[model samples]
Target: MSALPRPAHGPGSRYTARAATTRPRPARDGDVAALARRLTGRDLWLARMLHEHRVLTTHQIARLAYTSARSAQRRLRTLHEHAVLDSFRPLTASGSAPEHYTLGPVGAALLAAHAGLDPTALGWRPTTTGRIAYSPSLGHDLGVNELLTHLAARTHTASGSGLALWLSERSAARRWGDIIRPDAYAHWRDGDPLLPFFLEYDTGSQPPARVEAKLTGYAAFIAATGSRPALLLHTRTASRDQTLRRRLAAAARELDLQVATSSADFTTTDPWGPWWAPLEPTAHRTTLTGLAAHWPHLSPAAGLEPTDADTPLTLPVPPLPPDLGSGS
Candidate 1:
């Protein structure tokens, strides 16, 4: 007997596409007026700078907004609290302090929509008739973060039995500075503590030169652990870099690293977060050296493991609290 045909894709994929739209939907006017006002006002100024620059520190954002760093920080807090902005840490050259306050995915979407707004005296209007107007929602960020959290928690049991660890540019740089930072770091956390499987999520905007450098970085980092680790890469569009990806894979193997072209080779979940984060240790170590190694300057966390008490990760129904704004 032949094996049952695999589901086409996704949980609802087998259902007719027409059945998907049972509920009526309202076309969003958005807070177009409010959004426009913010865009033209001080509130959106930092967002605009972040959009133009891709990322910025609170100081940089403040300079663009002509506000004090503290004021800019407050605005940043508000934006993040409202899910209007997002932030991630990147290492300073010293790898001692991590820089915060950067445009997250949600912020990027809002800025994109604002930039695409129709220019008129009547102010902004939804372009739904001709081309749809898109407004990024906190829902979107909630969804993405949820997925990331889910993958981190579930990667070990995933079909691929991979480990997932969330790592930042700074940690990555400190560990593999000789190579390159791969934008985001994801590691499958199964066997060896030192060299768990890792991957990079490249939206395909990575330059060919940069791609080579990062490929080398992964190789070096994996080699340092003296273990062969999985190194997968996913790009939104692989058309342009087919050859580059092929080269990277070959290079990874030459260094005894397993390589995958896309996350698909590794998992079946669509929302199976492409991001991975390190796990919180089950037991806290008491020594100063251990504390320093584990959480750095950050004090001991309250709860150690994932549980209902901890925020629900990856489920987007009710938006999760902003990880940064909560100031935990």
Candidate 2:
């Protein structure tokens, strides 16, 4: 008999290998039901987050959920072992990539059962982890999550400032795809002022004009909904940020939109710091909280209420997981 071809493994493989620590097990309905009994509220919250955001690295997950990296890693590995979360580490030219997590079959089943739906209704296929591992927009997705994770992590601090609402691209699309498609939608709370904004994490892959054209959609959204949330354009480079500011200035003014621009160079550590520059001719940058004061006319985006068409499973995932102190 002819020899069978060996399956590819490791870096650059078409089918990226799952973490070696992951023990493959069949996740039948009964098996998943048994696994569900062992899952914590945080675990279930993590599953919902993965389902919404598509993927998250270990660092991001730790920042969002755990007080320590070791704890997050240990718990995440346990989740992977029971097939409650799937993970794959990508090949990197430098050091190894952190394990990226997605919703596992068991996790999906748990969520579906909680929502009183069939497992197939969750839209998670067996190839989900592999697809996210090799996705071209992986970096872009990670960058978006990193910014929001930082915002959410603020809740762990003694400071009373943190993200109040965060809607992933999928959730945002479901809510407002008819008018505009923001990369993410967020309501940030720092003290009494709440800064509601639509985030556009630009990677500079598209032309400046192309980026500016998105403003037209926002204009329509505002006109249709009567909500004037600030538009935050986050670019990969200062140069691209400058390009977008200049390119979109006239259109933004003409549409009477509240817009702010920031670059990755300026927002590495503290995104809520004085990194945002309004579209107007101002050299002074302002904090995210300050933006609310700068543009007092801006209103919170509407349509966040659960609609008649929405199932419990389809609701927006909470920005932060349930409090551990509450026995979650």
Candidate 3:
């Protein structure tokens, strides 16, 4: 029998002990390629998702990618041990936090290859992740992800629906522009029309006016691209929702934008369902699917693909009209 290396017992033992025990075996390029080849399409998609979102908890990953936690646990462990994924458990006053996973070096390389981009351009580093694991904003970021991840999850079981695309704040900035990068950009198809929306999770910290001002950018972006995606705002409470709703209405009327407001304290079992209310105070709460009908400027679809090419676009002036005006 061989004696294992004596565990460190001094300061930083928490990280040191854990690191020593679960160190993943290094996988060569050939090994990584082979493993990557063997991965199901879903596995690759999950990897791409981690790259886009920065981090995801074990529970969130399960809900987003797998039918159950038991199954997710088994495959995630395999990916972790094979150096395809990395995770950390934050030290917390409540004992320990859930295992939050991100793309490993190998995983990042695979994703970069798939995207036809440089691995270094992905902006991922182990040290950065370590720092992020302890940041106070981690909880807020995860909560935003959790809300969107659940919507992605529902696509699997929900009828005639799909989670077509989800872009994080960073991705949104790169794909669109930072003039208005949402917490996430989600595009999906529900029944007849394709729905595209942006999500903003507010913790009641930023002043209401500051949040409302972002609508100006969104309006300008929509005018330029001919893409009209609703802006979804989820707040800390119904009271907060009401307060924002007033400002959202003013913005919508002033800038000719489309905004939906909601509270995190939901009464329904399904969080993705009908919790959203349009900026209008008289409007009834509606589901994500029902949101598009109320906004006349949105681009809708009868098929899987978006109908942007066929839809006429407009570049309206500052403070656009309720309708973009002069659309072909």
Candidate 4:
């Protein structure tokens, strides 16, 4: 059997790779070290928290850093000006102020390099747009994961170049009901059946039955929509529950959904963190197209033709949110 292509490890590798590949005068070691040390202890903590969480408002960062909101805001703004971060206007809940702040690709890489044990050996090169940024999760947000799964399903349907389809209530309609509100989503706008991949760094209270129902919903969405988006459910959970696996499979069967499992026994299918986070469009098409195409064959009676790739893998990553206020 052909070896599965490995996922991109993290931003640290990307930076090292870029330095090696670029013809320009390479960034000196002193320069790099200076850049790393330029951050204050508080800044370092704030930066790490933002990169790992992927998105956090100024308020969140202040709370995490145990600093005044003004301090957090200044630190974030400084990071942004230094090209260490980017800001975006996030979609807020009705009647709530919009949350703002997420690490840019470069900022994420710098944080990863600083925090990682062997950043030099990693092959992470930050692309202008196609680059993937990963953050660590706190491992307690089940509700977040549930929403992520739904986002993955949506992404699978939207894999074209430079196009991003988000599923939050502001734009994309809710699938099941109002109760299951998804946060956000994006993918290339190609016609090809995309993979439904979820990335979550947190968890919350979620019942097993709700989880099972979600699996069913995803399966049905894949089957009915005629899109074979591969699903990648990510979390930092310690153990993969057998009950969850069984429920997922039963739901797939009920929905006539053919899922791609790593093992024949329907055990754990994919890794959950930085290891699984680096799949680019080129890598995805080469590594995942065959498996993704299986949906059409498994449910032949359904007569759904697999969607075609609209463009090369490309999508918009929203800007980071702005700082809320000083925590102090």
Candidate 5:
């Protein structure tokens, strides 16, 4: 007997021309049970998270949801078959890379339906979602998401702090694309002051001139937005961080912009430790909670400061449950 046909649109599916370029139709099953059979509340939540964050990896999703890797893999495969999520594997040097996933057209439609909003208004275009998995910057996009996910997980594990809000690159682009588009924007609540900052993740592949030019654009962004979010540069190596600092100084001299540099070379013990050094004169390595003191130009975190019960940088609230995934 012939084997049953596998799902036809995920990482393992055959790439037909129609599948490659078309938008997914909304699932039309009228029976609620049939619909529920297709997806769970947790599945819908995952879809919303993907919509908000733009992209994530299988490992990241497993962490976000309560399931084991095997379960996440099975669920994601089924969802992809129904076009609820689209995924792709980036070009890697050695073994296969973890599959990266983005919101698919059908998932977006479902979310839009629940909210009583048009999918377009919700930033869900069939063509757009269908095409995102194939983007050349998929790896960079995934890396940025990983950064936020890590912070969210870290906040739970740490003593007294957590993420207040996170804006994905697309959200940043919507507001600041005219001047500069940050990789990510986050509101970090520590003890004394709430901190709002723009994240720039550099792989050390872009030319120094190109990276430095962002400072000029950022100067314009600050003037345009009337918001002074500290610029944090995370580079691949210590040398790259040093070179980037020099470039930032030159750019600062030409245009008024403040930035912080950090090398992503730390061991796991303190992966998010005080590796950040402001571009200002007499800058020193400082933790994320300490950046506010170094970069005075940053605006007072708008209405997100922790209460008297919780001290900044110290744990006030109990750690989050492992399954809910930080809920940031």
Candidate 6:
């Protein structure tokens, strides 16, 4: 028999070019103002999100902001047409990668204007989209965003369980880069007693020792700030997870750092469920919320108090968008 051809996933198949649309022209001050007036609150919120997190996939944007995938596509296409967002479809080994959206020049300008600053202050260049599209850390960045976006999307439910605070790598670095540089930081709340954690999304690209060294940084961060947010190391495979769990257990013990680990193999629709295994001899796994009960000594992270140099623009973006009464 002849070899079979692989199936294309959707209209966004890597073989097909994205549907052509009217590209936005160079944005002037008046143009930005006009675009700003045309944008809704949800649009502005998404702009702020992209500015902070760098990029989001079409599916992620849909989950975060829309009632349905079709609605998200329509709104995102319009945003791209207005130059509030720019998208790229990566060539994958198989199937298709969803359109990944980044903050466009006009969107950057809009954010700057809202903050009462020049566009230069935003440090956004015309090359921003291209840079992120080709960056080596693209997968790592996306993995981090994926985990958090799942938590952020929980707000649409009536459970009152969702991300209370989410700081991107850049935002977390700005706060505590000197001591530690977490991949991301977040406060996940199911109800009372929110679980604050620092995510370290591992792709299994680095050696186990290098991964273990990260614990030292967390130890330093705790000592310096007196904050003890749990360190979450999520890896690609079960073997890698086991290897890390064995390698880092003693280090975590010596450093007295609150550490937990999970692998993609164990993940499901509820990432907040009992997928997390603390660095101990026990085989028990716990949900993100259950971690609090596991360790009674756990406390929320500190150092979020604004410094003299901080401005309203420099503050962390809220985890969820403003409720615009549009079911977004």
Top lDDT model: 2
TM-score of each: 0.34, 0.92, 0.78, 0.33, 0.73, 0.91
* lDDT of each candidate versus the true structure: 0.38, 0.84, 0.67, 0.37, 0.65, 0.81
Model 5 Cα lDDT, one tens digit per residue, 1-328: 1121334455324211233234343455343236645566677777777777777788877655644777778777767666677665544457766776777766777777766676676666655543555445655677677666766556546645656667677666655577788887776766566667889989877999999778877788777667687787887679998888887786775666667788767432343568888787687888787887666568722223455633221112111233453222
The most accurate candidate by TM-score is 2
Error of 5 at 293 (Å): 3.2
RMSD, candidate 5, Å: 8.3
Candidate 6 per-residue lDDT, tens place, 1-328, comes to 1111223564223322232123443555468777888788899889999999998999988888888888888888888877888777677788878988988878888898898888898889876776676666888898889888888888787377889889999988988898889999998887776788999999999999999999999998888878789999999888999999999999999999889999889983467889999998874899887887777677777888789977656788887767535643
Candidate 4, residue 300: lDDT: 20
Clashes of each: 10, 0, 0, 45, 5, 0
Per-residue lDDT of 1-328 in model 3, one digit per residue for the tens?
Answer: 0112322552222331243136665577678778877776666666666766777889887766665677778888877776677776655557766788877777877877776677777676655455455455676688788877777666557866756666677656655564676787776567775667888888888899999888888888877766777888888788988888876787687776678888778732355678888887588898777886677567521122334432111111111012212121
Q: Find the 10 residues in a row with the least total lDDT in model 1.
A: 127-136
Question: Cα deviation of 176 in candidate 6 (Å)?
Answer: 0.5
lDDT of 2 by residue, 1-328 (tens): 1111223653235324447334555556578768888788899999999999999999999888887888888888888877788887766668778888888878888899899998888889876776677667888898999999898788788367889899999899999998889999999889889899999999999998888889999999999999889999999899998888889999999998889999899876578889999999864799988999988888888898888999987788887788544322
User: Which consecutive 10 residues in model 2 have the weakest lDDT in total?
Assistant: 1-10
What does candidate 4's lDDT look like per residue over 1-328, in tens digits?
1112224563222212221122233233345456676665555544543443344545544443433656666666666655455544322245543234545444555655764534332232333212221222211222332333333333223444222332332222223232222233333222564433322221324555775566565555555556444443333342333334444665655665443322112212212211231122122212233433433343221211223421111111122222322232
Task: Give the 10-residue window scoring lowest on summed lDDT in candidate 3.
Answer: 312-321
Reference-based lDDT, residue 279, model 1 = 21
Better model by lDDT: candidate 1 vs candidate 4: 1
lDDT of 1 by residue, 1-328 (tens): 1111224554222212111122222223354345445432454544443332234445434433432557556656656644344443322346442223444333444555655532331122222111100112222222223233444434324444332344433334434456545433444332332223344655445576677666665556554544444444554443543555555645555654444444323333432333221222233212112222333222211112345532221111111111222221
Model 6 pairs in collision: none
